[model samples]
Target: MIAVPASAAGDGRPAEERGAAGRPSLWNIANVLTMMRLLLVPVFVLLMFADGGYDPAWRSLAWAAFAIAMITDLFDGELARRRDIVTDFGKIADPIADKAIMGAALLSLSLLGDLPWWVTVVILARELGITALRFWVLRHGVIPASRGGKLKTLTQGIAVGMYILVLTGPLATMRWWLMAAAVVLTVGTGLDYIRQAVVLRRAGLSAAEAERDRER
Candidate 1:
């Protein structure tokens, strides 16, 4: 007979397993913030295209909506972690919200002829591809966020924000370089995530095989 660890609370499972099984409710504050971000996506899109897509006032309002979405993105995950209320709903919805708002901004700018179509395609492709990869390997394990990924997000946000605003002269030129950096970061981090995902999946498969052998 095996002795159950005290941390398992007499259930014979590990504490970590228990924690995963008893995830917090979906209605928590963290998930609410993520939902708010998703709802802002359409609002941002409408504002971006308002006044024939060039009125500075409408763009400013769009920028305000984008900024709020970004700010909430930063807080929701941290709030979930700190409060120990991380939920599956948040895990899935948070990234979707992040991508939706960013994608909407990029697509709107490209449609307005403010940004290059190729640039929008590249960024959106990377974002969507990485998101697909995450779900592909989700049963194995999560690919933890890297510093490069965070930098990519920051650079992309700033570049997009600059484009949303009506700028001229030297500032306009600078935004192009910032966007270039963002594109490079997007591709670089995306490839790194793919590598990590492959490795994680392999490890998870090996562990599963070993467990089956033990059971046999």
Candidate 2:
């Protein structure tokens, strides 16, 4: 049986690889956009909190920034696919940037009474729990981003954006639906990760048993 080489395998030198070698890696264009998303986080926060009697205007700017960030979330992956610039760094940084921005926005909204405290807590708990789990499982192997996981992220972005944008009356009902979608996706994806983790563990155990049998 042939084992996969850790590096590019020709030179045999692993040059401190951080992201996926695919187009989504740090070299990838998608990841550049992901970095842009991270860069915008501070600006968004500043726009959110620079309230010197222009609270509503600043809030509106914050919403627009959030909207742009969310749009990038969709396009970066598409751009990676189209341009074929995916990388490992893209995977790690993309998600981290996503969670930081969303988490900050949600927390701010909750503080301002735009969203329910429980909703913010639920969203944040899901984000942190998944991130910690990702690192824990990385020791065993890379967990390729699943389709369901991507869907969950899209839902999360939409939900958080809706919550932030619908601060006024009337359209607030739509925001509630978005939040419900996010919650459902979060729970579903969490379960999906648990199942994947179990499968990976079982696969490792089976491989070990096979190796032992060969030795015997």
Best by lDDT: 1
Tens digits of per-residue lDDT for model 1, 1-216? 897655454343223433544556666778889999999999999999987999999999999999999999999999888777777778889888999999999999999999999999999999999989988999999998999999999999999999999999999999999999999999999999999999999999999999999999
143, model 1: CA deviation in Å? Answer: 0.9
Q: What is the lDDT of residue 120 in candidate 1?
A: 97
| Candidate number with greatest TM-score | 1
Error of 1 at 55 (Å): 0.7
Our tally of clashes for model 2 stands at 14
Score each candidate by Cα lDDT. Answer: 0.90, 0.74
Candidate 2, residues 24-110, lDDT tens digits: the string is 235445776799899989988888777641387777788899888888888887776565555667767888888878988988877
- Candidates in order, TM-scores: namely 0.85, 0.75
